[model samples]
Target: MAAGCQGCRTAQHQFAIAMAFQPIVDVETGLPFAYEALVRGEDGEGAADVIARVTPENRYAFDQQCRVAAIEGAVAAGILDTSARLSINFLPNAVYSPVACIQLTLQTSKATGLPVDRLIFEFTENEQMADTSHVKNIVDSYRKMGFGTAIDDFGAGHAGLGLLAAFQTDYIKLDMELIRGLDTSMPRRMIVEGVLRIAKSLDITVIAEGIETLGEYDVLRGMGVRYMQGYLLARPGFKTLPPIALPGELYAAVA
Candidate 1:
C-alpha cells in the first residue's frame, strides 16, 4: 500500500451509505448483462447527497468501503445466483495502489462466492486525476487480475479518446449528454457513429446508458448498439436487482 493511503484506510465516514442497483441490459438479447451498483443514503437520499460529504481525507476509505458494500449488498440481494455481472463504480484517484486497494474486494467476492470475473469496475471522467500513469497502472493491474474495466461517461468529461489511446478498456459507456437527443440530432448521431467505429476497431464494447425514450432506443438499436441502460428499461432498485423490460418487437426479435 502507498504510504499516503495509510491515513485514509483508517478514516471513518460520517454518514451512512447504501447501495442501489441499476441493470445494464443487452438490448439485442433483451437480457440483463450486468447490474451497476449506485451509491445512496440510508434514508432514501440520492447519490449526490452522499457524494457531498466526501473530502480528500475520507475519500480513500469511502472508496474502499463502497466496493465492499456493493459486493456484500449484491450478495445479500442474491446477485450470486444470477448470470449477470455486478458492475461497481470506482474512483481511480482514490486508489493509491490498485493491487493493494483490491484486496478487500477480492476477499468480499470470495466470501460471497462471486468469481473475480463476475465483477466489472467502472470509473468516470468526472474525477480530476493528476497522475495519468497511476490510473493506467490501476487499469492494467485490474485487467491483469481478470476483472473487466470500463470507462463510464465516455464523452461527458475529461477522459475520452486520449485515455482510450493510453489504455484499452473492455467497455465504454457513452455519456447521456450525447444520447439525450440522439433520435433527432444529426450531429449527435454523427458523433456516435464515429465513436462506434473507433470502438469497433479497438474491440471495445459500447453501452449507451441513460436511455429514457423509445425513439432513442430505436435509433441506437438500429445503429447496432446492443447494450443499454436507463429509466426507460428499469430504474435503480433499492438493494435489489430489477427485472429488465424490452419493447415487444425487439423482445421478440431477441427472444
Candidate 2:
C-alpha cells in the first residue's frame, strides 16, 4: 500500500469495474506491439458509460482502480505467454505524486510477473492537461522507472504540437479522424507524412490507430507506419485477447 494514500479506502466502493483489451498491431510482424486496456463496467459497458459517473471525490480512486484492473485483467488473460507489451491509460490530473501514485502499479507488476519494461502508460491529449509541467514529471518519472509512455489521440487534440514540444513520449497514436479515408484525401496524407517526419527526427515511434479500411491500412503502411490498431484488425476484447481479423489478401500483402 502507498503510505498515507487516502484514495485507497474509497476505491470502487460504488461500483465494479473490468478491462477490455485492444491490441496495437505491429504491421511488419502482424502481431501486437502492445495491447491498450480500456475500462469498462462489469457487464460490458463502454468507457464513456463508465466515466460519466466519476466525480472528483472518487477520481483518484477510480484512476488507481483502473490501473489495477488493467494489470490484473491482462495478466489473467494470459499476457505473459506473448511478447507484446501492456499499455494502460491514466489521468494526469488525478496523479498527485508520480512516485506515490505508481506504488500500486509497481506492486501489481511484481505480483503479475510482468516486467516494468513491458508496460507502457498512455495519457490522451484530447483533454488539455491542467498542468503540463506535472505531466512532464509523470513522463520523466515513468521513463526512469523503465516504463514506456505514450501520447494518445495526437493530432486531433487541443495542445497538438505545443504538447509535443513540451515533452516527447515513447509513442504517438494518430487520431482516427486524421487516418479516416486517408487514401482518398491528399491533405490528410500530407499532414500525416509531415508528422511521420517529425516523429522520426524526435525518435518517437508513431502508431496509427483507429484504422478501419483496407485502403487506409495500405496507405499508412506505404507511408512507413508500422504500429496500428482499430476495428479493421481486432476490436477490444472484453476480458480476453481477440484474435486479429486478418484478411488473406491483407495479411499476404503485409507479410
Candidate 3:
C-alpha cells in the first residue's frame, strides 16, 4: 500500500476485527477443500458489525486490512500446516490496480510462509459493481499471479451468467436458496443440474453452500457436487479452524 493508504489504514485502525474460518468440504476425500475466512468483530460479534465500518473514504484501507488479516489470521490458526487453501472474501470495488494493491498481500504471505497458491479470493455476486471489466481484470490478474478466485452466492444475485460469460474463476458457490430443500424441488434440482452442466463445460468447480439437511446433501452429491460448505459440515470458528465430519448415516449406508 502507498503512504496515503497507510495513513488511511492507520486512521481506520479502530475497526478492530477477528476472523472465523469454516471449511468447505470435498465429498470424495471427506476433508476440507479450503477454509473461508469470515470477518467478525474483536469481541466475537457478527460480520455485519465489522463490515459496517467500511465507508467510501476508508474502503481501500478496509479491503487491504481484510486481506492481510485473513492471511495472518489463517497462518496463525495453522492453515500453512494443511493442504487446504485459505479462502478470503474481497471487495472488488475497493481495488484500484489489482497488481499494485496485491503487493501487500504477497508480502504478508511471504512473511507468513504461506504459499501464494494456497490463497483463494472469493467475492459475493450480490456486491454491486460499476465496472464489470475491472472485476474480470482482478480475476485475470489473480489467476496469472497463481491465486485462486471464486464467485460466492452465485445464483442469487445480479450478473450471474453475465460474469461467468465474461471471465472464468476457479470456483462458484451456489446460493443456499437453490440448495435448500433441493431433493424435493424439481425446479431447484433442474436449475442446479443446468448449472452443473455449464460449470462442467467451463471446467469450473461448483460448491453448494447452506446445505443443512441429509436430503439436500444426498441430492447434491447424487448430482455430482463434490465440493460443499454449510452447517451440515461445520460452522465458522472465530480465530480458529473448525473440524469437519460427514453424516455417519452416509458411511453406514456405504458399509
TM-score of each: 0.94, 0.94, 0.93
Model 2 misplaced regions, further than 4 Å: 1-4, 8-13, 247-255
Which candidate achieves the best lDDT against the true structure? 2
> lDDT of each structure?
0.87, 0.89, 0.88
Worst 10 residues of 2 by lDDT: 1-10
Ordered list by lDDT, greatest first: 2, 3, 1
Instruction: Return the lDDT, model 2, position 39.
Output: 94
- As for candidate 1, its clashing pairs are none
Ranking by TM-score: 2, 1, 3
Clash counts per candidate, in order, are 0, 0, 0
Query: What is the per-residue lDDT of model 3 for residues 171-211, given as tens digits with 9 covering 90 to 100?
Result: 99999999999989999999999999999999999999999
Please give the lDDT score at residue 58 for candidate 3: 74
Model 1 residue 63 CA deviation in Å: 0.3
RMSD from true fold, candidate 2: 2.6
